[model samples]
Target chain A: MEEWTVKVEQSDNKKEKPDTEQLEFGRSFTDHMFVMDYSEPVGWHDARIVPYQPLTIEPSAMAFHYGQSVFEGMKAYHAQNGDIQLFRPDKNLARLNHSNDRLCIPPIDEEFVLKAIKQLVYMDKEWIPKAEGTSLYIRPFIISTEPYLGVAPSHHYKLIVILSPVGAYYKEGINPVKIAVENHYVRAVKGGTGEAKTGGNYASSLKAQEVVGKQGYSQVLWLDGVEKKYIEEVGSMNVFFKINGEVVTPALNGSILSGITRDSVIEMLKYWDIPVSERRISMEELYQAYLDGQLEEAFGTGTAAVISPIGELAWEGKKIHVNEGEIGNVAKRLYDTMSGIQYGKVEDPFGWIVKVKEAAPVK
Target chain B: MEEWTVKVEQSDNKKEKPDTEQLEFGRSFTDHMFVMDYSEPVGWHDARIVPYQPLTIEPSAMAFHYGQSVFEGMKAYHAQNGDIQLFRPDKNLARLNHSNDRLCIPPIDEEFVLKAIKQLVYMDKEWIPKAEGTSLYIRPFIISTEPYLGVAPSHHYKLIVILSPVGAYYKEGINPVKIAVENHYVRAVKGGTGEAKTGGNYASSLKAQEVVGKQGYSQVLWLDGVEKKYIEEVGSMNVFFKINGEVVTPALNGSILSGITRDSVIEMLKYWDIPVSERRISMEELYQAYLDGQLEEAFGTGTAAVISPIGELAWEGKKIHVNEGEIGNVAKRLYDTMSGIQYGKVEDPFGWIVKVKEAAPVK
Candidate 1:
């Protein structure tokens, strides 16, 4: 691990913190943000914390035209006793590098960048909402900044980390969401950018989301791009199904995103002696299981919601109800345990929590 | 068509023009650019031609995070008698709207935007290169500019058009280049954003291009994402093959871009009474044609290259040479005729040329 010196510049005019109860996802930002530049020779340099403001970019910047960009999503929780904590931050940074490789962007020093993120979060500690189900969402993204219009990898890049205080994903407790099984559109396929947390994958998914959203579905459950039969994901989250007393998830084919919360849930299930399997689970098999009354529960896992319960699935004009349109016991327990460990209320047996220290006093 | 007002603001400090012969593709931009803003209720508004400069965008803009952006590439040629002409600019604008629909961006009025482009090009008439094969490259792009970070369609957007003086794609005569058939990576699937000229498709292609480039190939021929057997595109251009005196190209499947130059080539072939077909083309079928000595020629068509002849193809540990690694007769004739019509040296039979008049005297 390299010890990189990150320069700090406090903002002269700090923003008034937003009301925690009214906080929206990615709407309000903190006063300061961590910034870094990357170019050839000087791989990644000029690390500094400056005021969160608009970026002056050329209209021909490669990210705007070529979509050579990558991002990560995580959060900072205002834990008990005034401590600030991060859940599986290292995993998120590791996934960021994986996404960079897929997008052909240069890699970052994850450990050093994690330190900078902690510092930025600490600098804006007041922005971390302490209300229940509220925390500061951390978005670390990299964009190709070169002004040339050529269709090639950019030499210049910008890595930025911004903090946004967000309210709970579910305002009225952990409720289930209706998901439409996508048939006409695809999110990603094997050998595509689906496994990476890049902008294009999300961009490609908007149409399907919009279409299903208009049909009164809260989100969409994406099937495999090839067969369009096997389950892949549900609204940018890794999906799991409890069938016949066993939990099964769509194995990470090349196109499925490797989710951190998905990893945590599997580990937690293993620790609790719950039967879990990651394999190719086809829609036909799931439907057969439903017909046999073996379908027990369904849920999605991600950093935002931690665990999202799927109540109903509409596939090819047929609706399939899961767990009688209620949150399953496993989902409720997983969410409680995950949120408990995240907010420092439960024992972190896996050592996934990283703490941010308060600023040291000047000598 | 509704007539709209376009405001103009000339730059106080105009940049010195670069040497025509020393120009590179998309490196040197013109002095001015056209821009328009789109928002809900207001729709597409504030069309203006302003000085070419950097854009001040929020760090959290949706374009940077989700890659909801689309762009079109065409050119303005400096004709033989100092007239500036555009080749099938209407096709490019129509395709731009198609891309907008796929990316969930607001659509632009093609007629209004084309008029704005002509006005901007007329304003920067001196920047159009006069060298033999050089011209002004026009890039019209739309980006989601909302500062919010939700994974949905953006309500705010920016439509911008910039001009860059580009040299000839081939410094010497139009020569053939080696291409590698990409096997491991996929560009797009049938239900994906492949047909749309969005950033994600290009971003997904960089890795395959980089891998093949290291193997001494200039470009990679993309296969269908689902089966990886059918040919989709070559580099960023639409590919065509002449087999047994008939030209065949991949049909407009949902996963292949609909190129304007490609359309021109098909129409020109039809006009010449040469056999041409747009259908699903498999690499195996092409290989069989080569084996039977029936493969006549292969070429790619796009705005940048106009016509790129394929000399050799390396696929699955086998190398197949086309036309003895030389430029084919049809490719040469197409390039000559296309460039001739674009530069105003030949007859325009298909009504493809749209001339930009000289700016009227300000009275």
Candidate 2:
């Protein structure tokens, strides 16, 4: 494995850290960040951890003009004993490479990149807030840096990792939110880049999101692009529903992101011997289930929120309240168990958590 | 209209202009450029023409991570009488607003932006190459400048216009080329950003482009995203077919970009009293037409090449030669007439040409 050079910031900015109680998602940054570059034939080189600063990229870089970029989001939890732990970061790096494959970007050594992420997190370990539900959000992304304006994959790329101290996703703590079922705008189709965590998918979703937000909904529930019948995903999260004691989610049908948290929820349910399934569930069936009082719960899972319970779903001018517009037992259990393992409070039988080692102070 | 501030470069770089014969598209830039800013409430402000320089954007800018960017392509022509002109630049600005609407970006005043474009183009008129079939390509793009990583429309944006003196799109003049019909990857779908001239749509096409490029094809003919059966577009251009005696191009479905060049071709065909139809045409129907010897010509139209004749098509291992692997009479006439009007060699009776006036030196 190649070693990553560490250049600690000469003027540390940790003293300007915001009060953890009022932190928002992805707003503030840590003192240091990790960066690497890749060029043709040279492979990925210049791996280093440097001070957090604005990047000087060419105006005509492919990333700005062609949208040739992908990013991964994960978090580092601060345990009660001051240990920093990451939940399933290996899966995130693996998914990043998977996204790169679909986007025609060069793949990085997953193990080596993960090590670099850990080192960067360790260097800025003090930024990990000790408050409950607070963690250091890590965003790792690759952007095309080639200073040309053509509709092709860039010849040069830069991989950057930045750390942000984020507070709890729900200010009031895990309250159920309403969502609007989007019928006009489509997110991804079978042959599209939906399965890949690329920027285009999210960029295409802003219109629907804005419309739904204006209607007082917290998120938009995206349907399959082809028929617009089958459920695809919710916002940027993988969705799940508890119908008649069975937990189900839309299958990874090449149009939904293979979320790590979604996978963990399935695993946790299966471990507890609860009935679980991965298959296509249409909105009609879900509404019917709700009408019959069999729709127990509906929620979204992602790294940022961990669990976002869906209270009411507005579909075609009709509303279906899930679990009495309140958090369901299944969602609460999953969120607690998942976050428990992440915070080192619960026993991790799946070998998911990777602890970070503290780094020595720089000269 | 408000007059834009002009900030000419103190150090002239006219001596560094590349030889027009060896010029590559979008590689070398001109001496000056145009810029404008958009923010909440203030709308678009600070319109100015400034020297071409690298932009200093934050690494966490929403444009870099979420692909909140849109761009337009047009060209400035040097007339035989030393007059500089633009061909239907109003149409480009109109299309730019259309794209901005789809991406949830704030729209600019079309007439005002057009004035800015003309002022900037006239200031750098020396960069308009005098070589045959050569013109100065103008790229006006808007990028989100908000320093955040959320998946939402940005409140702050910057519109930048850069000029590049480009040679003929085809190195050896316009010639018919071979294309492969892509069956796997999709470009865009109904209710997607395909209709917008945005970066994401172009970014998603690079993978398929790379694959076909390896198969010795110049471009990949894109199929509809949902069914992957009906023809959508070829590369970045709108496609056309001359069957028997009539000209036909795909109708502007939601998933197809309404290309300015494509519209011009249709207008020209109608002006010449040629039978033209804008409707959906499937590849199967095209193949059937080829089998019956009714497919007389095939070509693609866009700003970059204006007209790209398709001499050969390889689909599912079957190769069909278009017009005996030669440019058809219609394709030749269209290319000649288009270039003729652009170069001021033909009378533009359609009132499509807009002349540019010389700009005074900056104070």
Candidate 3:
């Protein structure tokens, strides 16, 4: 692997950190950020860590007009033992490449970018919240920066990594939320950019999310675009249902995002000797299971909310309560174990955590 | 209707005009642009015509991350008698609002934005190329500018209008191009953002275009995302077929883009007393018509290439030639009439031309 050097320019004036208790998701950011440029001749070069600020880009930049952008979400935990750690950073970087392939973007050296991210997080170590369930959310994204209006892949690109300290998803506890099954709007189709963490997939989903959000639904459960029958995803997360003591999730189809947290949950379940199968499970089957009282649990997995339990599903003007509209044992255990492992309070049986070395304070 | 005011800022230094014959599509921008801001309390405000330049936007802007952006494409022609005219500008603006609806973007006043565009185009009137088939391409786009990462609609937005001097899509005469039927890599599903002139739909199409481009095909004929049977679009344009004397196009099924040029063609056909209909036309049906020697012509209609004739189609290892692999009479006549009306050489019976009053040169 080629060794990549990232030049650091520390900001002289540091902004005051936000109160950990009042930290909002993606609202506040650290003082510094990592950036890299990609062009035709230079594949990916000019890596630097500079003061977080606005980007001077052309109004006709392809990313703004064509939506040729992809992003990944992860977190840095301020461990109980004063060590900063990353949960499955490698997995996130690998998935970034997968998204790049699907979005027609040039790939980056995963190991080098990971090193740059670790260095950026270390320099902003003080910004990491120490409160319970508080962590620094890391968002790594790529945008096509070519100042052209033609509809094609961009020649120039910008890869950016920014950090934000966020409070726990559920301030009270591991509570379940209601989800509305979407029938009119579709998130993705099999041959589309659904599996890729591209901007368009998320953009296409905002309308449906907005519509359901008005009806007191926390999120939307998307069905397959082709059939509108087979289950696809719940909001932006991978969804799973525990029916008759067996866990089932939609397979890693082309239209479904291959979520890191979803993979971790599957691994953990396998470790616990829980029977889990990945296949095409239709909404009709799930509804039948609910009718038969075999639907024990339903949950979603993602980086932000590790395990979001679905308490109620409203489909076609009918509502069905899962596990009496409460978090099931499987969901509770998964959330606790995932958060525990992330915060270094549990044994690292899977070696998923990558410890960050302390860096000298920026002057 | 409330009349909107537009503030103007001229550029201190004027850029040298590109050679009319050497002008490229969307590569060289005009001297000035129109911009407007949208926020919660202030709807769409700060409407201004400013010097064309780069935008200093936050790296975490919602448009770059979520693709919540929509745009419109039209042209300002340097007419035969020295008048600048826009063809169906109102239709383009109306469609822009329709796209805004699907992408969850706040709507802009069509009349106000159209007035702003005319003024901006007049201010930079000298940039419009006088060469045959050349014109100033006007791009009006709205981007989500809120600096947040959470998945939702943006609270802040910037609607911008930029102009570029584009050479003729066909440097030579209106010639036909070969197209490949895409069996994989769906463009947009019926329930997806296919109908919206948004960034994601274009972004999702690059891979398919690239693959077909490598095989010496000009564009890909996209099938319906649900069935992959019915024709949806040809490249980014709405497609049409001439079968045994009748012109047929896919109906405005939620997934197919409602193109202004497509509308114009249908109108032109009706005015010329030719049979025209909007209905779902499957690839198999087209092939059967070709087998029966009834498929006379195939063409695509859009703002870029007002009429793009498809000479041949390659599908599943089989190839079919249309009109003996030549441009058909219907496509030729439509192109001539449309471009003629646009350039003010032909009579505008439909009152589609909006003439721009001359503005004082930038001082």
Q: TM-score (0 to 1) for chain A, all models? A: 0.97, 0.96, 0.98
Candidate 3 Cα outliers beyond 4 Å, as residue runs: A1-3, A359-363, B1-3, B359-363
TM-score attained by model 1 = 0.98
lDDT of each: 0.92, 0.88, 0.92
User: For candidate 2 chain B, which ten residues in a row score worst on lDDT?
Assistant: B1-10
* DockQ-best of 2 and 3: 3
Best model per DockQ: 1
Residues A249-327, candidate 1: write the lDDT tens digits. Answer: 9999999999999999999999999999999998889888988999999999999999999999988777789999899
DockQ, candidate no. 1: 0.88
Tens digit of lDDT per residue, candidate 1, span B1-363?
A: 123788889999899999877898887898999998998978998888899999999999999999999999999999998889999999999999999998888788898888889999899998988989999999999999999988889999999999999998889977799999999999999889999999998899999999999989999999998889999999999999999999999999899999999999999999999999999999999999999999999999999999999999999998889999898888898999999999999999999999998644211
Docking class of 2: medium
Docking class of 1: high
lDDT: worst 10-residue window of model 3 chain B: B354-363
TM-score of 2: 0.97
Q: Which pairs of residues have clashing backbones in candidate 2?
A: none
Give the true-structure RMSD of model 1: 1.8
Cα lDDT for residue A324, candidate 3: 85
Interface RMSD of each: 0.6, 1.0, 0.7
